[model samples]
Target chain A: MVRKRQILVIGNNTNGCTPKHEKIAYDIGSEIAKSDSVLISGGLGGVMEASSHGAHDANGFTVGIIPQDDASFANEFCDVVIPTGMGLTRDYLNALSADGVIIVGGGSGTLSEACASYMHKKPMVAIKNLGSSVDPYIDGYIDHRKNIKIIGVDTAQEAVKKILELITA
Target chain B: MVRKRQILVIGNNTNGCTPKHEKIAYDIGSEIAKSDSVLISGGLGGVMEASSHGAHDANGFTVGIIPQDDASFANEFCDVVIPTGMGLTRDYLNALSADGVIIVGGGSGTLSEACASYMHKKPMVAIKNLGSSVDPYIDGYIDHRKNIKIIGVDTAQEAVKKILELITA
Candidate 1:
């Protein structure tokens, strides 16, 4: 049996982001479902919840890798909740488990996850967000390694499209 | 019930470290076992193995948080092996699960664990070593946060003692 491809979406939590960001995340999740890939996320609020909600609504498989020990801590939409009990370090776990990654209107935690994914050689793409923590790496590489540039996208469709293509290639 | 205190030791795998470093790590694990604290590490070779070996010989509990998906990857001395399957990012899981952290001779992976632990506000200390990657933070905090000082100790005994005291107090 072929293991399902898991695409991770990392971003701001319930706070510090705009409604537009949530919509994009939701769309990304929908796109992931349509492509027949599994949706994976931090399994908290904000973008994580929004994406999972979108996927759930679309009958897509969704997995939430949460930092807390309690499985119930996962957002209601997560079909599979893996409570890491590792606090914020769970960020790396999500990045590690995914074939590719995406960022949407994130702060410090998002940047850390993005950076960790790059360090581990995971391909990534980001939705363009003004003043977002990930702005520096949008359409560019995180550092000198330049292993795989963090591609920037204008729409949720393109974000998933680019990541799938990048990882498959 | 008072939970067992889990003390983590992070450091180089099997390479780039001296035998003297391994001896110190082993002694530190022995001290942790003697104090009835559970020992934790990356669960691979070098310092991780030596420390687990010391703790196991002392009949102490040892938990190895390994990076691979397979539990068999852990060093034999580990009593409990948590196969994270998150690759190098599993470094953060070790730091997050520990009440305190001790750094033996290490490289970039160790530094990442140390930094993540500090970010999550875990007390930490290091065995003083000349020109180790952790030398810069030996007597200071990782960054300006100075949330809790990363104490430096001369011997394994001191390292364990200082970290225990810092975490409890």
Candidate 2:
């Protein structure tokens, strides 16, 4: 039996996220559900919550890697909760669990996830103008040789499409 | 038997680290060894390497929480290697294992560690002028109530002293 694709969605946990960022995250979650892909996130508020809500609304399986040992940190939409008790370090677990990573607006936490994804050699797609603080570091590719590239997209649909292609290819 | 204090040293893991950062990390490691405290780090290069070397030179017990599954990712000075295979996510393990955290110059990775330490409610002491990228976020205390504070010191000696006070208190 073929395994379902797991995509990790990374973003900020604060209320500072704009309406557009939340909408994009929600759309990405819906697309992932429609495609029968498993959605994974940090399981906190803001973008993570929005995406999980979308996935749950679409009847998609959602996993949240929570930093605390309690399930209370998880959003309302999470189907499965993995309490890591690793604090923000749980970001690594979220990235490593996914076949591909989709980043929305984020801060240092999201940037750490991006770095971890790059180090783990996971394909990543970043939605443009998402208020991601790691923009300077994500210079298309991670290295001078330009072998590893963080694919950029303009919209949620494009980001999901790119993630599908990367996962399949 | 009383448990030996565990001191986590966080810093830049790249060649871009300045000479002064290296010296402070080395000093912090030496102090940790002299105090019979176990030293821990990410077990990579730059400041991590320097601090590990200092601890090893002092014959201190040093542990490296490696992000990769391979033991080779650990620095030469690491006496004990915990290969987590979790990539940068292993930073949480490093922070959680320590009685206190001493931060040297760092970037996003170190900033993630700082955030984790705050969330875990661990006492942290940062060496001043360490080129820490999380300066803006480190508003002394992490929360609105200003209960948790990250003590800032101007020198390695001061950092060690502060760490000892925090851990023992």
- lDDT string, candidate 2, B17-106, tens digits: 778888888998998999999999999988999999889898898999998999998889999999998767687788789899998877
Please name the candidate that would achieve the greatest DockQ relative to the true structure: 2
Q: Residue B34 error for model 2, in Å? A: 4.4
Give the TM-score of chain A, superposed on the true chain A, for all candidates in the order listed.
Answer: 0.97, 0.94
Clashing residue pairs in candidate 2 (N, C-alpha, C atoms within 3 angstroms): B105-B130
lDDT of 2 at A135: 61
Off by over 4 Å in 2: A13-21, A34-36, A43-45, A59-61, A66-89, A106-109, A125-155, A161-169, B13-21, B34-36, B43-45, B56-61, B67-88, B106-111, B125-155, B161-169
True contacts kept of 1: 0.04
- Interface RMSD, one decimal, each candidate: 5.9, 5.0
lDDT string, candidate 2, A46-128, tens digits: 89999998899998999999989999878888999998886676788887898999999786567767767776778899988
**DockQ for each model:** 0.08, 0.19
Error of 1 at B115 (Å): 7.7
Q: Output DockQ, candidate 2.
A: 0.19
| Winning candidate number (TM-score) | 2
